[model samples]
Target: MDVRRIGVVGLGAMGAGIAQVAIEAGFDVVGREVSDELGTAATERIGHFLTRKVEKGRLAQDARDAALGRLRTTTDVSELVDCDLVVEAIVEELQAKRALFVELERFCRRDTVLATNTSALSVTEIAAATASPERVVGMHFFNPAPLMPLVEVVRGELSSDDAVATALDVVDRLGKVAVPCHDTPGFVVNRVLIPLLNDCVRVLDEARVSPEALDAAMTNGAGWPMGPCTLLDLVGIDVHVHASEALYEKLRETRMAPPPRLVAMRNAGLLGRKSGRGFHGY
Candidate 1:
């Protein structure tokens, strides 16, 4: 399917970034938020992002304006009825996502591709809630979606080949590298990355080394751009805990389990950069 118009639900950090990406990629994008205030905030956030790109000489002012012109924001879910592809980037809870997809299936065309940007939830479970499970797929974009080059095109057990192909095509049009993976917890990147982050948490809990030292070891020794603690902060400690818990529940592996310190941090409302504290202060 030729996806000319895209709908992005939940205009949070990831959703706004995804919407910006689609707009810059020359797609007419309708971004949905739960309220008018949030919709406005998302729009402003996208504008700031584009303006920064222009300031950095990465994007021309005219190009930025054109991309902004093609984008619209709405509080109504019905605004997405005309979108060729609708990607849900809402809360990571299963029931909430399933509810949104079920509602989308009610209004969208039979062939309209419905995608979930869930990092750890079961795509199959979400798809099962819709009338046409074959049309549902997972399009897991990394954090800071506009800048991330990798997009995992996940195929649920019931996802149609055509759906997967269409998703991959959309990813290609956005100038991203698309890797196909099955509907497994964490898909691929988080499946491996989260475990490593958990291990880093364990090391810290054991008081083996300081966060700075551990991060330095990874960045200087392993040549990684950022260390685990830095990445965890960026990814949100609560998000890491949630993803780790989900993986552990499914895989029954200690490596996938979230460390006690991580859970404690989350319970204490120290949810990383967004919350101002996590493994380390923001």
Candidate 2:
């Protein structure tokens, strides 16, 4: 199935980014928010992103205007019925995600592919929320969907081959690489990356190293372009904590356990770049 018109549910950072990239790729995008205020904010966020591209000569004036013209926003779920595919980028709660997909299934056509951007949840569990489980799949894009190139096309137990193929085609159309994987805890990338990120946080707590020094050590000593401290800060300490805690609960492994420092930081609301203060001040 060729996907042209797309529906994005939830207009937070990831959702806004996804909508921007899709429209930049020449697809008609309809975005949904919880309220009109949020809908307007997400629209402005996308516009700002496009404006930055134009300012840097990365996007042309006409192209930026065209992308904005193809974008629409709404608060009603029923309005997404005509979309070829609907992707949910809502809060990372399983129950909430399940409920949204149920509503999406109610409004959207039977052939509309329902994709979730869940980072550390069960695709099978989410698919089971709908009568037509075969239409449900996971299209896990990274934090910055516009800049991130990898798209994990996850197939749940009941996800049909057609749904997976449609997702793969959509990813290619967005100029992203599609990596197919089965419905597994944390999927592929997060399963590995979470453990490493956890270790990074743990090291800081166990040692007396400053965040700057830790970052420099990794970048200069370990050959990593970005250090753990800086990377975690950019990724958001709370986001890393959530993913690590979820994986730890599911697998009950030491490697998946979140560091005590991260838990405390999350509680203190040191959420990195967005929060303006994480490992270092923004």
Q: What C-alpha lDDT values do all the predictions have?
A: 0.93, 0.93
Q: Which RMSD values do the candidates have, in order? A: 1.1, 0.9
TM-score result, candidate 2: 0.98
- Model 2, span 1-282: residue lDDT tens: 889899999999999999998999999999999899999999998999899999999999999999999999999999998899999999999999999998999999999999999999999999999999999999999979999899999999999999999999999999999999999889999999999988877777678788888888889998988888778889998888888888998999999998888889899999889799998898
User: Tens digit of lDDT per residue, candidate 1, span 41-158?
Assistant: 9999999999999999999999999999999999888888899999999999999999999899987778899999999999999999977999999999999998889999999999
Question: What number of clashing residue pairs does each candidate have, in the order they appear?
Answer: 0, 0
Error of 2 at 58 (Å): 1.0
* Cα lDDT, model 2, residue 25: 96
Off by over 4 Å in 2: none
